[model samples]
Target: MERLNKPLTTRQERFCQSFVIYGSGAVAARAAGYKARSSNRQGWRLLQSVRVRERIREIQASLADHRGRANDVIIGKLEMVYHRAMENYQYHAAARAAQMQAKLFQGIEETRAELAAAGIGRDDEDRDRETPNNSPELAGPKMMTFDDNSREIDKACTQMSTWKKRV
Candidate 1:
């Protein structure tokens, strides 16, 4: 669902954007200027719409930029969910949040390794913060192609072998 065949109404568009920002249906609905009395119900109802769901996903993907800061945002949100679930004694929800966090960390580590293999090592990553112009294309976690991913994996294996021999 790239663009909605029929564009969302102004209120629906506002609700979608606000939902992403607030991560709360009722809050987002109110923020979107829905009627206060029925905002809670409308909020959940709006999410049930296929067009609304796709539009929201599209908006979220668009918000993700080349810098990979979206990963940090995702991790932060997961951590917040984990903490809230734990506080409420929702064991299943807390566990799911923790699992998502681990998966995110795995991807981050692989991206760092791939960047390292590309000669933009850890130090270079830090230097890149001060100079954002360097390696703009490779800065994001999802920037690498399948061939590049395969090459990075091979490089990582070779480095692991050298590390074992050094020990």
Candidate 2:
């Protein structure tokens, strides 16, 4: 199962991409063309593979790095805006900047909460906590068919494209 350094088969690549998008083994398996009835089992098995897990981690790390850089730029600009507004004695502008900063902080807080809820940031000893798995980063509509699963993949691609454009 430890084949992370090896080349993946086409189906394996598809499965990895889909899993990265939706974070569901069953949905990703189905989207990768596994039989519907066996998708859950196949997906579970695939997820257990070391190669698959590694690929998923790689994708997530890349996204996180990209997002972190974007956030740094945004926060820097927001800080500048806040200072400029204050220095200009524009109380309304300053208030707006404050609101925007709050909103940005709230967004980060929400993401942190979501990651914690998803069992992502939990330590081994904290794995037994009763928090629900409701991470927005992996949330998607329940996939009833391959089309539904592929839709999530499409959305992920679109999001990456938009992020690149912004960057």
Candidate 3:
């Protein structure tokens, strides 16, 4: 009796069996004594066409469904990580702000203590005179001099020198 799906050839049957076992068209084609390496590429392309593509799509849809369930687990883990990072950032910021405020208050208190120790009240008038002006030239004592005879003496010296040089 003839088989319903008779083998294309004995070699073809062996090629199909080798492909199924090894999952490699190149190996199977070589085993089946196909001359060109491209014959294996064609075999692989044919396996991906039409009926084979539909079957593969079904398997891939099943895998995608499984991955969707795993995505929920990964999202939960990532949310926990996000919340932890935000909490850590907020805690560090609040701690740094508190530390800064404490340092500022401590500096103010020390300044107040120093003022009290020096017997200088905050509104003392002596502090105003003692406050140094920023200008270097205006900070020292001012001097003024008036000499009416100096110009006449300078003119006499100039005329005397000119007369001496000409002689």
Candidate 4:
């Protein structure tokens, strides 16, 4: 039921309710008994009413509140699922979370390696002797050659520079 303080005709109230349900003003107008050919115009006119807009806002707020409650219910169910998974020794979900965590930390490792290569070694005694790309052990699993990687890095840096200048 509409809770608008402002006066509205029954048809106008129907228009608001139908609009909320269908998300199409023309369809709502038609449902509210306007002729199909003129539904769009009538819908636009009804939308101009302060009372109608207020009623629509009330409907939308109610729908949002319902959705919020529904989400809470869903989260509660998910928590139960998580507990059940843990009890059943289902490691897949835990493993997936760990994989995501590892991916997030991948950047940190790359930055640390880069910093070590820049003469700021992880240990103070170990001096930065050569570029990371030069060290076979330090070079990543891809085994990318120094020249190819260097060219790619240069190209990317150039493109970034061009983009920065444009921005």
- Model 4 compared with the native: what TM-score? 0.38
Sliding window of 10 residues with minimal summed lDDT for model 4: 139-148
TM-score of each: 0.47, 0.42, 0.23, 0.38
Q: Which stretches of candidate 1 lie over 4 Å from their true place?
A: 1-4, 66-70, 75-167
Across residues 32-98, which tens digit of lDDT does each residue of candidate 4 receive? 9999999999999889777898889988778656534343333333434434444555544423333
For each candidate in turn, give its C-alpha RMSD to the true structure in angstroms. Answer: 14.1, 19.4, 38.8, 21.2
Give candidate 4 regions above 4 Å deviation.
Answer: 1-5, 69-167
Instruction: Please give the ranking of all candidate structures by TM-score, highest first, separated by commas.
Output: 1, 2, 4, 3
Lowest summed-lDDT stretch of 10 residues in model 2?
A: 139-148
Ranking 3 against 4 by lDDT, winner: 4
Q: lDDT of candidate 4?
A: 0.61
Superposition-based RMSD of candidate 2 using all C-alpha atoms, in angstroms: 19.4
For residue 32, model 3's alpha carbon misses the true position, in angstroms, by 1.0
Write model 1 residue lDDT over 1-167, tens digit each, in one string: 43548889999999999998778889889999998999999999999888899989987777654234667668766766766765775655656666677788789889889988899756644556453667644444433222433443354445545663443
Instruction: Write candidate 2's Cα lDDT for 1-167 as tens digits.
Output: 37457887899889998887666899999999999999999999988888878888887777655544455445645655655655665545555555676677678679879998888884442343233584543432221222433443354445545663343
lDDT value, candidate 3, whole model: 0.47
Candidate number of the best TM-score: 1
